[model samples]
Target: MSETDTLRDNRDRGGPAQPLVLAQNLTKHFPIRSGLLNRQTATVHAVDGVSFAVHKGETLGIVGESGCGKSTTARLLIGLIELDDGTIVFDGDALGSAISLRDMRKSVQMVFQDSYASLNPRLTIEETIAFGPKVQGLADPLGRARDLLGKVGLDPNRFAHRYPHELSGGQRQRVNIARALAMSPRLVILDEAVSALDKSVEAQVLNLLCDLKDEFGLTYVFISHDLNVVRFISDRVLVMYLGEVVEVGPVEAIYGKQAHPYTASLFSAMPSMDPDNRTMEPPLSGDPPNPVNPPSGCRFHTRCRFAEDVCSGAKPALATFGNHPDHLAACHMHDPASGHSLAGAEASA
Candidate 1:
C-alpha cells in the first residue's frame, strides 16, 4: 500500500494504530579494549534488547538518566550506528533488507542536541537547509529552503543569509528542524533538540514543532532527559534504564500511575514547583552499576527498593498490568501471582 493509504488506514482504525517505526530486540554493545594491541577485553552493553514503536503522527518520548543509551537508540534507528542485533521496521518495510540505507535515510532524519555542532559553520542558513535537498537531487532547493525557513517561523529574507554563529540557539535549532524536514522524511529522531535552549525559546520551538507535525504528518522519536518537556511533547513515553526498556505507556498512564519502580524514581526526581511537597524517600541511591559488568536479571534491582530475590535471579518481561493493557512494565512487582502487592507503592505524576 502507498504511505498515505497506510497512514489513512491507521487513522481510521480509531484506536492504537500500527507502528510507523517498530524496533525489536535492538542491541548495541561497544567493546572495551586494553593494552598496546587494544585487544577487546569486555563489552559495554549500551542498548540491550530494547524494543518499542512509534505510531504514525505520534511523538514517542524516551527518557532516562545520562548514560541510559537514549542517544545510541536514536542513532541506531536512523542507521547512524550499526546494530549488533535486532530488527527495525519502518513504515511496514524492514530496515537493511526491504529498505535500502539510502531510502531509509530519506524516510528518517535526525536532529542532534547541539544545533551548532550539527550545522555547517561555513554554510549560510539557506545553504545549510538546502544542502540535504540538493544532495537528494530535489528541484528548486533554494526555493524550498526559503519556504521552509518561513514555515519554521524564520524570516527567509532576513535570516537566510546569516551563518550558524550569527543566529541564536533557538533560531539555529529551528534551522536544524527545517534541514531535517527538507528530506520530506516520515520520521524525525530528535535527540534533546530543545534541551539546550532557554525556556521561552524552547516553548516557541516546541510550538513550532507541533504545528509542523500537524502540517506535515510527521512521526517523532523524541529523546530527552527533561521530563517536563517530554511530558509536554510526547503522546507516549518509554523509560529506559541500563540499556534496557523498563516501561512503556501513554504519557497520562505512565505519569499518573507509574508501574515500574525505576519510573517512579525518575518521576520523584522531577523538581516540583510546590516546595512544601518534597519526596520522603530518596528516589535513587548509589551509582549505576558498571555497564561492562552489568548485574544479572533485572538491571534496576541494584537500586530499586522493592527489589526481591526473584528480581536478581530472573528477568521480568515487559508486560501489561490488570486493566491497563496498553501500559507495560518490566517489574516483578507488577505480577500479582508472584506474591507482590502494591500496598506501599508510590505513584508519581
Candidate 2:
C-alpha cells in the first residue's frame, strides 16, 4: 500500500484528527535481586508516574542528564518494553491493546543514537531501508526505499549496495533515517539521533531533519542529553530527573524564564554563545541519586540548590505559569492553585 492509503485507512478507522501521543502516569520498575534464588530485593523506579503528550506535527524534546529515564520513557511510549503502571495512549488507543503494535509500527518509527550499531552488519543499505516497507507490504518497496535514500541526500545507485561498515558515520546515520522514513511514519522518536556525530556533521544532520520534518509533515519526540540541540529543534521541552518531569514549557520559556531550579541549572550549565555577558552558572555537582531508592518528595532535591524542607516532604504537581496555559511545570516554585510565585525558593541547594 502507499503511504496515503495507509494513513487514510487509519483515519477512516475512527482515529482522532489531531492525534495525541501521551503517557498517562506511566511507570517502570526493574527488580534487583540479591541471591541465586533471584528473589526481588529492590526495585529501581526508572520512570515514576511520568506524564506528557506529543501533539501532531510538533516536536517535543525530552532532555536530561544520563540515567534520568529519558530513554526509558521513550522505550515505554513505543512499547519496546512493558510498563509496570499507567498507559501510553497513542491516537486514543492504549499501547499493547488488541490492535497489535505491529499495525502501529508503520506509523511510529525510531532513529537510534549509534547508526553503526543500529543497522545490521550483514544487510546492505538497500536491504536495510527496504525491510520496513516490505514488512508493511508497501507496493514498489525498493523504489520507495530509493526515493527515501534520495531524500536523505544519498545517491541510491552509488550507495544502496554498500554495507553499513562501508559508509561514513554521517552517511550511515542518513541511511538509518531513510530506513525509518521508508514507511512514512507520522511520529519519529529520535533517541539521541545526532549525539554520536562530529560537530560539523551534526549540524548537517540536524538541518536535514528539519527539512524532512517540513517535507513529510512529521511529528518528533527528540530525546537528547545535549541541551543546545534540544533547544534548537524543540517546540516544547520537558526536563526530567530521576524518572519524573521536573518542568515542561515552550523552548523559549525554558531557556529564558526557567521556573524549576533543575531546569534553570540545566540552562545555566550550557556554555554561553557570548562570553562577555556570561551569567551561566557552574556545572551541577554530585551524582543523581539512585533510582532504586530515589529521594523522598522531589527527586531533584538531592542536587537542587533551591531544595528546602518542603521539597523533601511535599511532591509538587504540574502547575501553569503566568497567563500561559501551554506552560506547565512540576515544581514548588509555582503554586498551581493560585499561580503565584514562591519567594526565595530558587536559591535553597
Candidate 3:
C-alpha cells in the first residue's frame, strides 16, 4: 500500500497497525533541594504518568499552558532527559533495552523554540545543518546540508555561508529545521518551534512544516500554546494540564466537541473575530496551581468552573466518552457506559 493510504487506514483504526513511537505511563519528577546541606525537600511533578502514541506519518499536536509538561514530554521522547518511570517503544524496539540511545537519536530529532539560541553563532548555516550528519559519519555532509536548505525553501547558494546572526528570525528557524532534518529522522519533536515568529512568518513556517512532513514521510509531535496553529497542523490533538493528559482525540473531536472542562476553558479563552459573539464562559480564573503540590484528584479542578465535589475527591481515568471510543477524556462527568451529560454543569456558575 502507498504510505498515504497506510496512514489513512491507521487513522481510521484509531492508530497505526503498529505505532512508530509509544510511551506508556511516562513520569518525570525533579527534586527540589533546600538548606545549606541541600536536602531534597520537595519534588516537581513535571510529567505525571503521561501516555500516548505517535503513529507513522501523523502529526500529534500537544497544547497546554506553560509548565504543563509539553516541552518536558518532548525532551523525554528524544532521550534528552531520563524518565523516572515509563517505557518508550520506538518502531517495535523498547528504548534503553533493544535500542541504544545513539540509535534512537538518529531516528528521532527535535527542533526547539528559540532558533537563534539553538544554532551556534559561530557556525555558518551550512555548517550548522551539516553538524549532525558529520557526527554520525554520513557521507557528503555538506552536500546533504545544501540539499536540505533548498528543500526547506532557503536558497543554498545565497544563505549557506551566512551565520545565524545574519538571518531574520524566520530564516534562522528554517535553518533550524534543516539541522533537524539532517539526520533524516522518522519522528520530529517540535517544541513551540514557531511561537516566536510574527503572524505572517508563523504561517510560512507552518506551511513549510506541512510540506516537509509529506516530503519526508515524517511523523511529528508538535507542542504549542497556540490553539489555532495546533488546529491547523495537527491530525490528532492531546490536551495536557499540569503534567497530565486531560483529553486526547482527533483534531475534529477536540475542536468540534471537547470533553474535559480544562480543554473547554482553553477554547473559551480564544478571542472571537465577531464582536457580537463573545464567549459566555469566564476565562481561566487563576494560574495553574503549583506543580510541586498539585491538587489531589483533578489537577485542573481548582480553575475549572464546572468542578464539583466529586472532582476534588477522586481521580478520573482517561477513558472513552459516549460512543466515541477514539475520543478520550479524564473527567468525572463522563461515564463510558451510560455517557452521562455534564453540559449543563459547564453552563452553570
lDDT of each: 0.87, 0.84, 0.88
Candidate 1 — which pairs collide? none
What is candidate 3's lDDT per residue for 81-149, written digit by digit as tens?
999999999878889997898888988899999988999999999999999999999989999999999
* 2 versus 3: better lDDT goes to: 3
lDDT of model 1, residue 95: 87
Mind sharing the TM-score for model 2?
0.91
Off by over 4 Å in 3: 1-16, 279-281, 336-349
Counting clashing residue pairs in each candidate, in order, gives 0, 4, 0
Candidate 1 lDDT over residue span 181-291, tens digit each: 888887899999999999999999999999988887888999999999999999999999989999999998998878888998888888777879976777899776778
lDDT of model 3 at position 30: 93
Model 1 poorest 10 in a row by lDDT? 340-349
What global local distance difference test value does model 1 have?
0.87
